[model samples]
Target: MGLVAINLLGGVLASLAFAFVELRPSLPFLFLTTLLVGLILGGWAATSSPLAKLYGGALTTFLILFGTGLSPLPASTPESFSTRIGFVLFALAYTLCMTALLWRAGRAAENSRMA
Candidate 1:
């Protein structure tokens, strides 16, 4: 929990710094940064953990992106109901992909620690 909080706060700070540097970053750039940074932060948190708590890393990252306005910002809202649902599904897929990557890194870290 402490690790999650730390990463969350750090992510917020990083987002703030990014905003300061680029007052109007392109949507694609923002998304690229968000995903790349999120993965890095997630992996770092996993490595720091004494245990491979993948859920914690994923939850922390999802919250961090949400809190920092990194998610749902790169794209505008669609008018159709189905489109909205599609967007939501896309977000869910993004989270799942992130979790899968982080889980692998966390599992490796856990294995290394046991050796």
Candidate 2:
């Protein structure tokens, strides 16, 4: 319950900050911000979960950094094929990372409770 609320709040705040600062409305930006937020909030959730005990905080940190932080926008320019590929890869990776982290955290929390 608390994890869900924290995740939602963090995602909303990150997205709002990006939208206002960038002054542009784009799906990719929203996705990236939300994923980053999830990674952060998910890490907090992990401390109470079994996975954190097994994998430790670094795994959570890596999951956040690699999963949400490796956006390809910095690697690509606007007027090139690479830009398109970068955007696609960024979107896919962001979505996958968020999904995986959330699933892992939730499962771990449930497992810890069961144990």
TM-score of each: 0.35, 0.29
Best by TM-score: 1
lDDT of 1 by residue, 27-105 (tens): 6776776676666656666775664454355446445444444334555422232243344456666776888899999
> Runs in model 2 with CA error above 4 Å?
1-80
- What would the TM-score be for candidate 1 when compared with the true structure? 0.35
lDDT of each model, Cα atoms only?
0.54, 0.49
Whole-structure CA lDDT of model 1: 0.54
Question: CA lDDT of 22 in candidate 2?
Answer: 52
- lDDT winner among the candidates? 1
Clashes by residue pair, model 1: none
lDDT of 2 at 102: 99
